[model samples]
Target chain A: MVSVAFKKNLKEKYGIEFNNEDLLERAFTHSSYANEHHGKHNYEKLEFLGDAVLELAISDYLYRNYPKLNEGQLTRMRSNIVRTEGFSEFAKEVGFQNEIYLGNGEEKSGARNRKTLLEDVFEAFNGALFLDQGMSAVQRFLKQTVYPLIDEGDFDASRDYKTELQEKLQINGAIDIKYEVIAEDESVPTFTVQLLVNNQKVATGTGRNKKAAEQQAAAKALKK
Target chain B: MVSVAFKKNLKEKYGIEFNNEDLLERAFTHSSYANEHHGKHNYEKLEFLGDAVLELAISDYLYRNYPKLNEGQLTRMRSNIVRTEGFSEFAKEVGFQNEIYLGNGEEKSGARNRKTLLEDVFEAFNGALFLDQGMSAVQRFLKQTVYPLIDEGDFDASRDYKTELQEKLQINGAIDIKYEVIAEDESVPTFTVQLLVNNQKVATGTGRNKKAAEQQAAAKALKK
Candidate 1:
């Protein structure tokens, strides 16, 4: 049974309570718990739904707000915000660690405090929120938590390779560096990125997709 | 400009029409074309948005319909539906190839009919629909095309390992196989799968995550 304290906390924090409390319960149910119980279902499906919901919210937010940022920038931003560390932090902030349902063995392993479980609860809650109310509710929940993080520029830590590389190279004095897509292979559709410093190519990196290629190139350049 | 016949075709097919013809036009506008035009913008942003919109729609649909399928299965199903080949096929069916705007140089190079361009158009169009209408409109648009494809079970091709392996083994007559997780190393968080045939361990495979481990093990077993 979900606690009155948890429900009260939700009302205080997210400013909405669920009409179907069972959905809320299921959102916190770990797979191990469901496997042990005869009829209980886990949060895996909800996590799947939540993952998609979170993706939509973050993508939409990035799309509308950061008009000047390219797709790669937006993608990197979303990744920073929704990654396991970020999600786990959000879960902890919202008191999800205590609310998570676990099996006897899992609980003995201190599953409630596990980062993966916490991260998952954050997503499952998103799925539950989307189901309970709609897209608008999910948006509202994100606005309160995620939007603030964006405002603080907390998610900017990753994919700042250019800055890091520049800073590193600046110790040796002014440096000129550029990244160019050296190849775009059609079969796998990967982009091979080459980093050039002082008009000479120094490092090369390849990503199967667009976003990672530039970062990978920069990261390799920094290492050199 | 988006053609009147194209608009009529969309109306006949999707039963929906866009109020913002500009968005529709932008969806077909390629980067090379925009670079030459001096004033026109490309469809990259729209494609990014569309990718998210498409992800959300597909994920929600899978979550609702595939009640018994786990997260990995849902992920594979989504990947098959939205991958380059699938998106290109969808774009061709909707006549997006002919509609694509390209620079003189690009057109001469046959960029307009390229599979990557076709795939981009499919995503950009989705983004346009979402921006012009909303989430509901995007869902409606996908329901007309992608929903039917899912219903047809066309995505069953990717994870048919059981069928394939069984077929291969049946020729040899009566095979007993058991897959066990011998080790789960957290540094990579990989599941090491050991495949036992007739109670004798035949092969082992490792994957960075859960979904691919069993399949990798199966594939290795078959190779043996």
Candidate 2:
């Protein structure tokens, strides 16, 4: 049986209440508990659903808010926001640690603090929310929990060299740039990219990999 | 310069008009063309961005539509919908072959029907749409093009043993099932799963891999 106090606390924290107690229970029930019980309940499937839901919510939010942001920027931002650390923090903020049901071994080990566990729990919660309240409610929950993080722009900007190169090329009237992995070795594989102007190869670069080579090639071509 | 007749034809067929003619042109211009042009224009980066956008869009639509679908189901469905064959079909339906601007060599080699080219062009188109009209337009276009195929259940049903096992377990009130990859070898790895009831291993199975073994174990447990 779910504690009324726990439900009430969750509602106060997330600004939502669960209509289906089973869904909430499923969210908190760790795989270890299901293992010990011989698999009567677990959060694995829910975790999977929650992952997709979280990605969609974050992607949708990013897409709408940053119209000028390219796809690469949006992808990196989504990855940063949905990473284990971010989800764990979100789980703790929403009071999942206190409310979760864990097996004896897991409880003793402080599995609640594990990044993977917390992230899974966070996803499971989203799955539960979707089951209990519906997609709209889950979207609302996601917007509340994740939208603020996106607005903060805490994602790493250095990770988007590809987007940067594309934008730079577009601005320079060199609209065509290609990255191809022509060779791979044990070390850094060589990537070859040829920059074109009116269907002519103006610049070619070789690097440790396709991305690096492309960036170097683009940078070189830009100078011309 | 974009052909006026082609632009009108695209609008009539796709129900979308190009806001930025350059974006559309860029979408159609392949890396080979850009490489031949000396890197003045290319669709490779756009293809990359479009791939992500397409994935997110399809994932979002599936999440919203399938309330009862667990994460695995949604993932399998998404994969089925976005696989090479599906993309090629979508490309054909959209008349992409007619619109895409290919290099002379690629054109002669029938790159238009090539799965790789089709997938890339589809992704590039997605990138172009996202750039031209933002997320809403991309989302709408994806929903119209992809969602219906999913709704019609245009995927192999046999690929979802995990889901079937879960449903059976749920129905039978045998909630405890656990899968573990016990051993791996050069040829076929062995997996072990125990189906428990009140902390007892009621049934156990072995298979080529953990997932297959778990499913078999679940199947055996369900029979009891």
Candidate 3:
């Protein structure tokens, strides 16, 4: 059973209050725990629901807020936000390591601090919140947590523009993709790269290195 | 541009009326068309949004309607609904092939009826509807189109229970998966199969043939 004090603590710390405390409890209850305690609900079903809920929330936010971002960029940004490590970090910040219930065996095996478990719990928590209070409440809660991280550009560093460009161009059928270094400034040590799709010059960029220049050109092509 | 008569026809045929005609037009405008016509917007961004919108709607429907279904079943069911062929069927029913805008070359190449394009158009239409109204509006549209098909078991035939069970059990780590014919009744022309996950007899089934019995056993294990 989840304590009244724990519920109060959630409200105090995270601005979240659940009317049905059982869902909140279920959100933190791992399948291992449920297997050990017969007939108890686990977080798996809730995690499934939460995954979709989070997708829509993130998609809507990115679509509206990032008008300049293309579909590929928006997709990449959403993936970064919802990835295992990112959600695990959110769970850690919420102290789920202390709150989560697991089987004695699983707990002994360090499941409490496991990244995948923490990520599942975070999603399950959001799923519970959505069921209890609806989408707007979940959005508000995200505003307090994930939205700030998004605003801080926490999800931007992992984009591989070159790969994205290749995928987009190849979606219809296989086509020739080339990134050619056109010129180099010896004094400044800068390389200029041109991106060609089927030998048609699409975009150009200059950077301190060849890879960076190629990536920059690909990024430009994606924007085009 | 989307004509007033086309809008009226949509309202009469499918109970859909768009407040923003421009968004409706954009939803049907292919990238090829947009590229051919300078400054014209395409359905790519809207298709991205619509894809997430559809995912959440199908997920919510499955989660609420299938109380006995586990997360694995729910995911598989959702995939069947949102797959290219399924969405393309919906697009065909909506007469999108006639309404869609394409470039000269694309139209000449018969892209208007292309399965993937139709699926993208179906998603883009829903996305535009979501932006024009809200999630409720999109839900209402699906009630008229996709939801009935789901209720009719249109998405049920493609289930591979064996693959699903394997995926679920293997998510934690790889384990030995075996299906053995435990018994055979030649006179009755039936076989009994037992599914063993890591040497544990999890579930059993009987069917007219070995393959059928194995699938049934796998399905039973998944339900467990």
Candidate 4:
């Protein structure tokens, strides 16, 4: 049973006052908990929904706020903010560890303290929060959590590998730097960009987009 | 210059009447097109936003319509529906090839007709549409295009690997099966699940999530 104090604490911490207490409860209910309790619906579905909502909110914020950053930079920044480590960190800050409802086995194994599971439930909580309160609620949650981090240049201070690599190679006199897109494979289907220096291919990297691949390739080249 | 005729046609064809005509213009403007035009924003930013919007819409639909399907199946189905092939197909149906603005070079080289470009423009259009008209309008576009395809079992029929792999190994009588998470590399940082049969590891596969990794592992094992 979810305590009223927990709900009140959530409201105080995140300003996320849920109208649907059941949805809020469902968000914290892990799959193992659901399975052990005879096929009850778990947070997986909510996680799916919340994952999308979280992405859109974050993407929208990045697009609106970061005018100078190209799509690739925006994407990488979003990835940095929303990826597993970042999410788990945010989830921990949101104080979900004590609130997550785990099955007996998972509880015995200390699954509530698990990093991956912690990240997952935040996404699920956002999803459940989205269902109960809608996108604005999720947006509000992000505004409080993700936006501040972005504003503080937390994800922005990462190395510009392509710039670094280009500068390094320029000492050998000016050479042609071309990044070409290799034919994409259908499995996960990301674009692979190969870095060609003076018409000789140095390294290749894959990403969901071209610039990201080029950056990775540049990083690989620098390493070499 | 975006013609009024194109806007009228979009209204008639896809039922997308834009409140912001500039956004409509921006949506069709490719990166190459923007580069040639001098400081004009391209569709990439919108594509980023729209990509997330399109995903959330498709994800929301899949979640609601297919309750029995787990998050893994829901994700695969969404991927199939919103992937490059599907986006290009839907974009072609909406007559974007004729309307898309390519740069002089791209126009001469037939980049407008390119499969990947076609896919990209639709995603950008959705992003622009999402910004102007919001999620409901985007959902309407998907309903006319993506939802129908989903209903027709277009993405439903796929090879069931786990079942096939199980049956194949069962011919030898009782076999031990285990899928283990070997090591998670934070670079791409997806769960890498390794399949084991009779305590011997067979194949490993990676995914953004566990179930997807397991599916890929199963698929690999089936092939073996």
Q: What is the lDDT of residue B76 in candidate 3?
A: 80
TM-score of each: 0.73, 0.52, 0.70, 0.71
Q: Rank the candidates by TM-score, best first.
A: 1, 4, 3, 2
Residue pairs whose backbone atoms clash in candidate 4: B50-B127, B176-B198
| B80-129: candidate 4 lDDT, tens digit per residue | 66763667767766777778888899899989878899888889989998
TM-score of chain B of 3: 0.69
Share of true Cα-Cα contacts across chains kept by each model: 0.81, 0.19, 0.78, 0.86
lDDT of 3 by residue, A61-120 (tens): 889888988888888888877773667766766667788889999989999999899889
- Which model is ahead, 2 or 4, in terms of DockQ? 4
Q: Tens-digit lDDT track for model 1 on A43-106?
A: 8888988988898898889899989798778878877777736677567667788888888999
Error of 4 at A174 (Å): 29
lDDT of 1: 0.80
**Number of clashing residue pairs, candidate 2:** 27
Prediction RMSDs, each to the true structure: 14.8, 17.9, 13.6, 15.7
- Show model 3 residue runs off by greater than 4 Å: A157-224, B157-224
**Chain A vs. true chain A, TM-score per candidate?**
0.71, 0.66, 0.69, 0.68
lDDT of 2 at A222: 64
- TM-score of predicted chain B versus true chain B for each candidate: 0.71, 0.66, 0.69, 0.69
lDDT string for model 4 (A1-224, tens) is 56777777778877878798788788888988888888567888889888898899899999999999999998898887777266765676667777888889999998988889988888999888878887888888888776876775656626768888899999989989999998575334366888999999999998644545777898899999
DockQ of 3: 0.56
lDDT string for model 3 (B120-166, tens) is 99999999998998888888889877887677555653666888889
